[model samples]
Target: MYRVWNFVTNYSLLLICGALIALVWANIDAHSYHQVVEYPLAFNNWVGVDAGYWLKKYGADYGVTEVSTLKVLSFHYLVNDVLMAFFFAIAAKEVWEAVVLRDGALRGRKAATPLFATVGGMVGPISVYLGLAYFLGSETYDAVVRGWAIPTATDIAFSYLVGRLVFGAGHPAVRFLLLLAIADDAAGLIILAIFYPSGELAPEWLLLSVGAAVAIYVLFNRLPQRLDRGKQDRPNSTWVRKKLSFWPYLIAGALSWYGFQESGIHPALGLLPIVLTIPHADRSFGIFAEAEQHLTDLLNHIEHILKHPVEIVLFFFGLLNAGVEFSSIGSPTWLVLAGLLIGKPFGVLLFGWFAAHPMRLGLPQDMRTVDLFVVGCVSAIGFTVSLFIASVAFDSSTMLGDIPVQDAAKMGALFSFAAAILSVIAGKVTRVQKQNG
Candidate 1:
């Protein structure tokens, strides 16, 4: 009963927030939504406190006098390409802590978390998206490269927040859930790197980016084991320790971003070097190996400082930019809405449990099936990455002859947001009922 209340409180708020955003966007047109009524429509009001300013600024900054077509495209590219790289870097840091830095919760979930997460992650979106694609003779939208981003992402902040509430202190499986989310994040990054917008860029630049990436990877794999500076356990040379500061990585990452940008790749793949270069050497980590062990706290420290900001930005970016005015909201497009929020939870729940069943992998020891349902709800919160993927998949260029793909991405994200809300409500209500019972 207590568990139910916990889930409801944690899961329900996100849904409510999403609903408010969607309602405001779907119902109101762009400029009208920006206009603050009763404020007497002052110039400051028009040009301040909202996307209205930037939307106009981008129009001028990009040299597009008209806000009709190219302005939105410029805004879309700026937000998705530039702002999102920071978001992705933060995600990569989480992954770094999980897979390489050895975060504790991640350690606990190590056994089957990655596998189930990978599978559950794959099935839900493909099923929902492809099913729709088959139906309309074409699920033709723009920013098609963006589609891959949705399925691969898991909102770790929201998930972990729910996890703490649901699992309290004892359940080791929370860690596993954390790891699974990490894995989901990695998959999303791969999908973005491979599938996001690319065009005919100078092959030489593309090759340079690829080469740099490979070189960085090589250095990462070998460098970790060899660093012997301060007091790292395995052993390493003293000199390598000094070099681990942030610059070389910044340089490599910056260069890589340039190459990728020139090469026609999404350009954000440049964030990888920063991840590769985090100093893994821990003289203080030896305490964990002894009778009284504790690497977890230290891992948490590194993860928090390096990783948390990115997720925060990702969420903030979505709220600020991805939101649509829901003034005209209603049917016809509800299937896409249903597919994202509704079908997503259903398909993932079915498949996730199915993956668990044969192995008799009951819910995470302390978790109820309903808790799993809530997890499914959280999975449906695809905001940050979904917006990114939508932008990528439906290239800003792939306009439907006249309908701009950027607007289509904005619309798709709106639907995805709604879908997340519905799924959250389902979970929240069920949880609340169980709590009351």
Candidate 2:
């Protein structure tokens, strides 16, 4: 049991394995698999009836009924945005938790400059959008700009896996990887909350949600210090202590789900709220006080339950949202995919490299700063988050050739994902960083 936990903690490959399995499942079954991840309304408010009426009107001349159109669009949005929130939260929680635990390793280092990498990450994707937007007319650009923040964000698992393969453990790249990734994520989330909220805002409801989060934070703050002492004081029964302590973070996460959904930001931001609820593992106990030991044990237990599902759900949701007619990849897709794959690294490397040098924020002694750009390139793997942005950015009513904005989103995500994978693998195979070094 300890060995299993140790492996999952050291690397999240197991989580990725689960994600691949789920993606395959979603593709095989399609519609039914899509439903389990579905969350149509923020407050469980209904949209199907009115949405059907409008979608039907839009597709009527083309013989596509509004009902079918609305069904597809709504399902796509819910799966990508609503479901992917949990994925983001779980990824965010793991990376953030690791950074918090690794003691002073990055407190003063230039490699610790997550903010600089974050800036480059943000600039890279939006730069892609701005460049693409030039080809688009004005009205189209405004809607898409909301989603510009999407392409910049990176999943911790994806970024870290690449880092491990590229940097090798002898390098201090691990610390830099955690800082920059978390900072980049935090920057993206902040932008999303501000720019990408639901067009419809219920201020009173959002306020209530904020109140709920503050209250949760306060309540947990009041929890017993060194939970081990509390455990030793009572509960002679280990089973009782084990069961209750194990799920604090998961329960906290679900509550955060409800809160963020109500709070106007996408509900996926709920992951951070849940992360806040997870107390730092009380590692101070060399004594291994049963209570602190249990808390440590509890994290080991809860991490699997909460974390594995995130990858599985996101990967499958991505496949559902991303599977485009490969037949369409010829002109537009190849161009778009090329930009994300090629252009992103160019911008990120150029920008991150320049930024690191002026500030003397050198790369890990073992890592060439050029590798930072590689991380940035991988960060461009924006499938889950980017698709969510597309849902909010494009209109189902808006036209793009034979497809709607939602369809364009699906295409873009698949292209970006494919590009990210190929480029990163290519970076590895060619020793791009090594050549640069």
Q: Each model's TM-score?
A: 0.64, 0.70
User: What would the per-residue lDDT of candidate 1 be over residues 177-286, giving only the tens digit for each residue?
Assistant: 55556677778788877766455556587666556656654564346554533565643422333444344555566667667666666766656654655455333221
Query: How far does residue 28 in candidate 1 sit from its true spot (Å)?
Result: 7.3
TM-score, model 2 to reference: 0.70
lDDT computed for candidate 2 = 0.53
- Root-mean-square deviation of Cα positions for candidate 2 versus the true structure, in angstroms: 6.9
| Candidate 2: residue 100 lDDT (0-100) | 55
Worst 10 residues of 2 by lDDT: 284-293
Find the candidate with the highest lDDT and give its number: 2
> Cα deviation in Å at residue 213, candidate 2?
3.2
lDDT of 1 at 193: 71
Clashes of 1: 30
Best by TM-score: 2
Model 2 stretches with alpha carbons more than 4 Å out: 1-83, 98-107, 135-143, 166-178, 226-243, 246-255, 282-300, 327-339, 417-437
User: Which residue pairs clash in candidate 2?
Assistant: 55-66, 56-66, 85-268, 228-291, 228-292
- Model 1 CA lDDT for position 254: 69
Scored by lDDT, model 1 comes in at 0.49
